[model samples]
Target: MVSGQLFNHKLLDVVFENANYGTIIIDNNGKIQYISNKYCEFLEVDREDLIGGYIVDFIENTRLHLVVQTGKSEMGDLQFLRGSFVITNRIPIFDDKEIIGAIGTIIFRDLDDWKKMNSHIKDLLARNNLYTPEVDQANGARYSLHDLIGNSHEMNELKERVKRVAGGDISVLIRGESGTGKEIIAQSIHQLSTRSTKPFVSVNCGSIPEHLIESELFGYEEGAFTGAKKGGKVGKFRSADGGTIFLDEIGDMPLHMQVKLLRVLQEREYEPVGSLQPKKVNVRVIAATNRPLEKMIENREFREDLYYRINAIQLVSPPLRERTEDIPLLIQHFFEKAKARIGKRVNSIHNDVYELFKKYSWPGNIRELENVMDAGVHLSNEEFLDIDALPEYIKRDSENIRRDSEKIQKKTLKELVEETEKEEIERTLKNCKFDKNKAAEALGISNSTIYEKIKKYGITE
Candidate 1:
């Protein structure tokens, strides 16, 4: 019976000794008062070596001191030891609302524990093959749907259409001007779709040389060409398997490549260059072009069959000039980003500078706007971006518009343009602003167009 009692006592002691947590106690004077056996083992020291020693003498980082000083609980995941990592929490031990000392618990975490978390993510993207964080991070250059930045009715409808189209696996053809975020819209569609977790591979069809275009889309086998990779190389289509492959400037793809691409679209399969075995990939092709494909088809530069296949879903991103209302938001977002990046504190954008922006036709669209702002931020020494700091295009355009607005005011030219529009719109709204049928008749435009511009231009009584 006495032996049984002793055994139970020893087992209880062992249970306490081998507990998973390492506990440490420190005094207000930054000296360690007590450390549990687990901590002594963790620090690779004896009880005598740690007790009554300054905490800093053991732990090299001073963040712990700051936590004790502020009497706040601090927690973090860190590599607390060589080849060992831990998640630690340090809490202040208070006596009657006064922080007397601190007690900390360090819980070692195995690296393999997080592997399970990303395992599920990996399973989802296995078919497409995984892209590294470096690829995703490299592409995240403030280019997304957020850059659209408009609350107009037309914009809202367009967004709704995009949302509906993105949910499916249909091929999308986005049409817009050079800088008008057609590629951005394509990316948005990819991000919003079920394939968002997979690779969003992009290829500028126009930029590839004629000789290399075939090998680029359908990667070459080893010794297929003099400079091919040692093993077999994966094509963009295969790389974007089970995901989205954005073909930017698709109108520029050569006729021969277009015919080859059309076959892949028709059959949903492709063979790598110099490889006999065909690789079948389930990729949603999102093609974008500024060129009019129908006109190109007439010119025989683009294939009609390819056009029909890619145009299953169509989106047109209006130029920035058409959506001038969003210019303010775009300006603010870009300025804030620029300020944070360049370490500046600009108070505000100048009224004249804004006027210049509004007057200038952004031929390059949103990209040009950003470039202009970037230049303005770089050159400005004052709180606001002044007119003199603006590019010559903006300055010249604004001056011409101001001169024209002044010269044409209250004249026949104004009557034929501004007055004509305002008078027609006002007359339409006069007969019950809520009456869509009457408004369409009075305005001599479609009911949809009136409704769109009404919300667009903020035309409210």
Candidate 2:
């Protein structure tokens, strides 16, 4: 038994040292106990220097000690190491309800591996854009007006307004809740405009670091900073010269950057980082944000002049809840798309599915609906999508609605009939959670009729 245990320990040691990725193990006290040879090599340090030392002594910006203290795992966190980024997983070790130590694993062997992985991910996204309606063939915009699917009056009016302004070169401000297709509207306007042939550059102001936003938007000169690209880097504005630059989450832009953006809009020119000469560019701006800009302005978080500049032609993308009439159409579109992508044989969705969908306030709007449909298609094993395939949160929401509805008292015969009808529909939906068509068949009614009844009774799930 001792020999076997010794062999197992030896095997573990070999595995840790020879693993392609770097590994580090530290005790609960935050003292480094073990450092794999790979990790030592990656850090350019001798194991003897680190093994008995506190982790902070050698590693910069490390949270492994915090993980040990909090007894929580931090997974797939990107950290700057050496001169490049590395994806790491720091997991706390537990022993019989007590915190023991922690293990930190570097996902990439080197910076080259991280770069290769990033490139592959970008390629996959580009390929996906080809399949979805999110991209325009002629303009290279991520989405066009045709991708904006809806039949509600609000949607129709929004579409008409977009078409009217598509011919003009005025700055547009798109306002809406999160996931309300702000970016899609921006892309559509870009695609339909006269600058359709030119590049439609997009930048998320919130995503770029504060210090880097100016250089990223207006380009930079050679030696603009320590690591500025050689021969300078072309900013999004220059890249979209004579085209459109869609600035997403504009509300999150820093006040200083907002001032610079305002200047670009006013003069149609911008100075690159480390350059005194202002470069001219005929770039149309379409900014979108979920933030309440008026409130931001009141709070002094966003600039007032910049707000007015971008708000010259404002378009509001209505949230899914406000346009519940479009739920069925959006569902059908998403379902068909998801089915084709997943190679699912499913051809029909149950009316109860739509019933539940309509009843639920879609906080994430169309994006959330698409995600739910995609998930449903992948989860479904039958020929149709039903309540069983819906996400757990959706199901729980429906249950809450049903429970709340049960409290309503029926005083009249008409009310009693309505209550009975609602109860029956709810029960049927529950039993036939895997097949909405089967539920409709059991009720001796057409699928469309069931949908009408669900809408009338406000039956969910």
lDDT of 2 by residue, 1-461 (tens): 01234224346568886676788888788888778777877787887888769998888889999998898899998665652346789998787777777889887555345444433332234345633324345445766666788889999999878877776678899999999999888887766555665788889999999988998899899998999889999999998887899999999999988889988999999999999899998999999999999999999999998899999999999999999999999999999999888887886898899999999999889999999999999888767899999899999999998886775542577877887888888899889993668889998999998888888887766
What are the lDDT scores of the predictions, listed in order? 0.72, 0.82
Candidate 2 wrong stretches, greater than 4 Å: 1-138, 410-461
lDDT of 2 at 273: 96
When summed lDDT is taken over every stretch of 10 residues in candidate 1, the lowest stretch is: 109-118
Q: lDDT by residue for model 1 over 1-461, one digit each (tens)?
A: 01234224245346545655666767777787667776666566897787778988886553555566899888763422421234577888676787777877666322233222223232234224442223344333223444456776656677666666765678999988898778767776665555665778899998889999988898989988788889968888888887789999999999989988997888998888989888788888999999989999999989999999999989988888888877887888777878788887778888877767776789898889888888778777757878877778777888889898887774886456755676667666877555866888766789898888677556777
- What are the TM-scores, per candidate, against the unseen true structure? 0.60, 0.60
Off-target runs (Cα >4 Å) in candidate 1 are: 1-143, 410-461
lDDT of 2: 0.82
